[model samples]
Target: MVLKESLLELLKIKAIANITIKELCERADINRSTFYSHYSDQYELLTSIEDEVLDELQNTLQLYNHSDKNETFEMLQRIFEYMASKKDICQMLLSDYGGRNFQNRVMSITHQYIIQKWEDEQNILKSHSEYVTLFVLSGSIEVVKSWLSNGMEDSPEAMARWINDFTSNGLSCIPKNENSRLK
Candidate 1:
């Protein structure tokens, strides 16, 4: 655990690119042998940390996946609450300093979930489902990243409410007949 703790602490102040295994071992007060026992390199240690966080997030989201339609909003609220509880780590992983791979992984997780939800529904986005999925996933992730960047100024419930509202009403806000004009 010392290695993970040390890596996280180092990540807070420095980008992963600048972090070396020797530095991590020094900060962790562990010898190179001990570090090598756990991870072969700095990148391996960093990835292990990322895998743990993603696993936790996936588990949390899975808990709400089977809920009833009426509980959708509540599920969203709980998801935000879960993220809030892990704000420090989430902020670090979602930060600009966080590698593009990590950010893309987060989006991929969300995108897959949305796709599953759509599959479970009777009336799904029959038209351009791929684009719609990306639109929704990207929009949601951006909002979350912005919230985390602001140090999560709003309560999780409040942020969830805002997000849910936007998602629920966003379609109606778009001009329904815009396609006709293009023709």
Candidate 2:
């Protein structure tokens, strides 16, 4: 916990690329031995923090069982609320100072979530499901990145509704079987 707290504080003042193990240990009031006992290096420590964030996001998502539109929107709201609660971490990860790896990891996780949701919906796609999923995921992530970069000024519920509207509306354009219900 100290290491994570220290790293986040340091990230506020310096980019991840600029932070060093010695500096992190000092800020954390711990010795190098203690630092290395937990992590091989600074990058690994940062990655652990990212993993923690991802785990929390996943936990928030696991609360939902159904794939209905209302449930999906509720899930999105919880995700945004979680992110808003951890704005410091989210902001740091999304910032230009934050390495691309963190952002990519976030996007990858989100894409996986969307893919799972789409699968649950059992909707038909004109193209490969992977392509359609990627299209929706990537576009949604861009909108979220912009929201984060802009300080997440909008309420999480408001942002979630907007994202839900955008994604569901776009997905409606995909051709489907006449017998299938729109997800």
Best by TM-score: 1
TM-score of 1: 0.81
- TM per candidate comes to 0.81, 0.79
Among all windows of ten consecutive residues in candidate 2, which has the lowest summed lDDT?
Answer: 120-129
Model 1 misplaced stretches (Cα beyond 4 Å): 65-69, 120-122, 125-127, 171-183
Query: For residues 79-122, could you state the per-residue lDDT of candidate 2 as single tens digits?
Result: 88888888888877767666788778866776666666666677
Candidate 2 TM-score, true structure as reference? 0.79
lDDT of 1 by residue, 1-183 (tens): 888778778878888888888889899898999888878988788788788878876776676652244365676788788789888777777765557767788778866766667656635764655677788768888888899888889998887777666666775544457558654
> Which residue pairs collide in model 2, if any?
none
Instruction: Assess the local accuracy of residue 123 in candidate 2 as a C-alpha lDDT between 0 and 100.
Output: 70
lDDT of 2 at 84: 83
The prediction achieving the highest lDDT against the true structure is 2
